[model samples]
Target: MSHIQKLLFIIALLSSSVAFGQLTEDPEDRRDQGKDPFKTQTVDGQPLPFSQRLRFGGGINGFRFGNPFSLGVSPVVGYQATERLIVGIGGTYNYTHYKAPYYTPTTYNQFGVRGFAMYEFIPSILPNLYLHGEVENSSIQVKDDQTSRSNSVGVTAPLVGLTYSQPISRRFGVNLTALYNLNYNDPQGVSQYIYGSPLVIRLSFF
Candidate 1:
């Protein structure tokens, strides 16, 4: 071959070899084409891995100088639409009875209902910890049977919280959470709104 033709042939061969080396060195190039990053396949069809969870719990608060105590019940249900996002509904019921001096004994009952969507800042299983928040609408009703007086108030309560959960087994775990409540309404005539302090609790369940 002529000198110029030989030089051209060598350059073409080197260029092809470099491209071949690149194809072998990059592992991701062999992945399936036309694959969607946000979609996955399931037994039924192309569906996301969605999960549903239900939790119910009860707690009591006793007054320091009173015999009458408060009883509470809360039930929460959540659906995980993605690895780091959850949508949920929770409801709470509370009842307390007390007696005032020179007055008939009375009872006060509070009922709350909330629905929320939350996102996890850190999504992992091991030593699980995340920043969680929820916005909820709640209603409070105060009824006095003796006086035949009834009061009903509706407000929005936003909760900003942090939760950490540790797994003990496949069906059992423990979690601790701290939460703050935000109130949306101002007090009106003969109606007062009060906020309690934040709450911290440790929970264990199956």
Candidate 2:
């Protein structure tokens, strides 16, 4: 009778062990199941939370001729809304020294605010390429070269462009973009050296 009881106890223990083993999940499977599909993965192989996927970038241009000097800086902050889409806000400040043939050199300062979006369409084939668009409003102090009088003008510009990005590291990179302004001929628009051209090249860092 004691032998029979011992046999039954051993069988019960084996059954419980099998059941527990079947109920417990593998560690790797558990980790995979817990991952959120909407989370953005960083270049460093770390997962970034939705709120933490903010990026910042900008560009600077400076040039000097014999008598004319120009400097411009634009800074932007963006949020990664999806794996391939980014939306941002930007601001620009530019200073230029205009020296006409007969007139004295006049200093001009311009300030602008813009909203922009970028979408990566062919990331699999070209990971660095993106389509860019922006709408900007600029307030410029226009100075009369001959009269020495100044007036403020507000300009609204809508631009579309393409951007190519080169990544140097996980957090740092460079972007080259060519943009065309749609409202370049607006009568009320401020005269922009960069936007006035058919093709404008911008170098930015992220």
Candidate 3:
């Protein structure tokens, strides 16, 4: 071939190779393109791994005083669906002791299961503030004063609330919430004390 023709052929081949490389994305980048950006990014803008999105935590509530004492524990497992949302399932167990100066003391045991969801507000004026909702069903057993027999009752409670979260570490956070139970006033409900007081405070960790 003539020298001029050979130089033109080499230039054309090199140009085609460069174009081909530019058109094909790296395999890693192609894989990343399928991922949801909101799910992958942490609050600090770092990429979060799928395994790290699984979270486990719960909370304890109640107060122990002279006349009436109560204690409860709830444990949950949750998935971080997105940077702004999380869903979880949990179980609860509680013990209560009630007494008056002139009346006999009564003790009761309660157990429940719950499902919950939380969504954080965007452009969050109060950082990490979220709206929370939950549905729970509980069974309670108490001994009758006259018959000395145990009576069992069931209650379904659905609650809505607001939560404030504080991140303590990359994988851990603490949340405080004030919840109002919607079914607390149900006519068929047997839980009078809790029904009369519908507002509940919850503290949780995740």
Q: Tens digits of per-residue lDDT for model 2 on 1-206?
A: 69999999999999999765544322233235673233255333445654456777788744334556777888988887776787889998877777878446566777999998889899789886999998888888767676888877788878899989786643346988787888877776455542445455678886
CA lDDT for candidate 1: 0.50
Tens digit per residue, CA lDDT, model 3, 1-206: 99999999999999999765643323234235673224445433555665667788999754445556777788988778777888889998877767756445566677899999989875347667889999989898876554577877888989999988887754468989888888877776655543336776778898
The deviation in Å at residue 171 for candidate 3 is 2.7
Judged by TM-score relative to the true structure, which candidate is superior, 1 or 3?
3
Q: Top model by TM-score, which number? A: 3
Worst 10 residues of 3 by lDDT: 22-31
After superposition, the stretches of candidate 3 with alpha carbons farther than 4 Å from their true spots are 1-39, 42-49, 102-104, 145-147, 194-196
Residue clash pairs of candidate 3: none
Compose the digit string of candidate 1's lDDT tens values, residues 33-115: 54322212232233433321323332322122353444555566665555455556767665655565633555656567766
Pairwise lDDT winner, candidates 1 and 2: 2
- Residue clash pairs of candidate 2: none
* Higher-ranked by TM-score: 1 or 2: 2
Candidate ordering by lDDT (highest first): 3, 2, 1
How far does residue 168 in candidate 2 sit from its true spot (Å)?
2.9
